[model samples]
Target: MNHEFSVAEVMTTQGGTMCQYTEMTDAARKRVRAMHNWRRSQLALGNVQNGRNNYNCSQAANMYKMKYDCDLEKSALDYAKQCTLTPSVAYNQGENVHVGPLENDKTKAIATVGEKCTHWSTVIRSSEKKGYPGKTVNSTFFQAVKAWWGQIFRNGVNQRMIFLQNLRDKPNAPIAWSQMAWALSTRIGCAVVNCQSNTFTVCRYRQE
Candidate 1:
């Protein structure tokens, strides 16, 4: 897939202003939820590795199982439709977005019901881009959420007495992961939209 991104907003095409919308189907949503819970279960079971060195990370004592929320999906879709790089989710919600060229033939019918439109491949070539070094990019929406959960590799549970508080002060704090594991955040919602030649994905988590 191409790394070059499109500057055209989801609301406007290169030729004119218009909006095209596509949404996740029931099957897609179920798969997304399964992906999330499976990754979280890995951490809860201490079966995760650090992206930095493939080192083993400690486990979570009580990672909550996540549920899909249509309200959050609506909120995420509301922002995703804009297809902006900047995050503007509600103050009490956490958000993650990915933008890139739509290349995989499977994703071409992303708007169609029951289409196999999940997962893609990419490489994260810079630690500077992601605040840590890694060979693979979390190209799937579920993998994107898993990336947030991966902060344990860098900011382990023993880092501080109040980890999340200290983490927020860091230059490249893992806010997404923190939110993902925010014990109280039991709900999530996500959406994907095609903007001409690019794909925009956004996910929202309930925040405490």
Candidate 2:
């Protein structure tokens, strides 16, 4: 059903460029839909790793911008991300995310507070627990991916998740993170919510 309406014919692209956007063009909408088809095909062909798809948002967005010189736009990007994710096998097997560091690098991996912090993705990639809040255990894993994708590149995962969950009537409502859409976009959806909420600010500083 969703695949059919893919990307909502995403209303985020205009004049072959990205902007706050006013109206989406037919060509851009087709491109977005085609992207979904490609991802589904990749999944069908077993082009996945670690029990989930590796084709991530930032990667795709950056590549699109570099290759096309236009913003991939968050709405299109989120659709791309959501279309590709499948739950980890651990989640499917009734296993929770067991979020500890790699045993060799606990400090750099899980220490989000105090002790001279380093990088956010480092901590998140390592510490983000596999288990989710509320009834996510019973919901579709793709929706779970969207809910958490809302956290990537952003601080306050716990806070955001709390807010999102509170907005739900049931566990499923919060899982559809795409419904939030970027408030500043004509139709752009969130990539990682907003730039101010992103880890890039901290992570980039760490690199500097």
Candidate 3:
């Protein structure tokens, strides 16, 4: 859930002096896996938000570099070494290079458009009904939250449902909203799907 970036480096200290070094460690490898997972999740979310086939890794890397002021190559190499040593971690090195800002911005723009489209669609639906307008209102609000939950929870429907139920029943009930909100949340709860599509289809779309 945390996407904020920091420079990842290997360091060694000798003669009371600290020097930056690059080496792979089990902990560092774990961090790399975590970072890559976070990045992939962001990309998946971006694609879903944009209704697109996939997101460019180069663009994502560029965004990370710009936002965090870290060298992509060093980070990537470090990550790759970790992946190589760690049997559970598998990644395509060629697909992970960072490109720059323009592509990142375009990706964000596409995602924004998708978000706006969903918002407008919800508003229109809500406005068309009157009875228990409260329910419609609650449904609308919940729907948005559910969409977010869908992304955050990924394919875990049972987990999402359990989380939703817990939220609704929490003592403070921070989620307390109109019936419309509940309706919206219900819609979102029902929207879960596999995030990854066929690689060949994605490549072909990119070619076009």
- Tell me the TM-score of each prediction against the true structure: 0.61, 0.21, 0.18
Q: Model 2, 176: alpha-carbon shift in Å? A: 8.3
Q: Which ten residues in a row have the lowest lDDT in candidate 1?
A: 115-124
* Candidate 3 overall lDDT versus native: 0.22
Cα RMSDs, all models? 10.8, 19.7, 22.1
**Backbone clashes, each candidate:** 1, 5, 20
Q: Which candidate is the best by TM-score?
A: 1
Winner of 1 and 3 under lDDT: 1
Could you tell which candidate, 1 or 2, scores higher by lDDT? 1
Q: Which stretches of model 2 miss by more than 4 angstroms?
A: 1-22, 51-208
Of 2 and 3, the candidate ahead on lDDT is 2
- Find the candidate with the highest lDDT and give its number: 1
TM-score-better candidate, 1 vs 3: 1
Q: Rank the candidates by TM-score, best first.
A: 1, 2, 3
Per-residue lDDT tens digits for candidate 1, residues 1-208, read 3333322121112221111223445544556567777877876676766435545546676678888888777777676556555537376676666554444422322322221011121111111121211111123454445455666566554322134455466655655555555555688777655444455566677743
The whole-model lDDT of each prediction reads 0.50, 0.23, 0.22
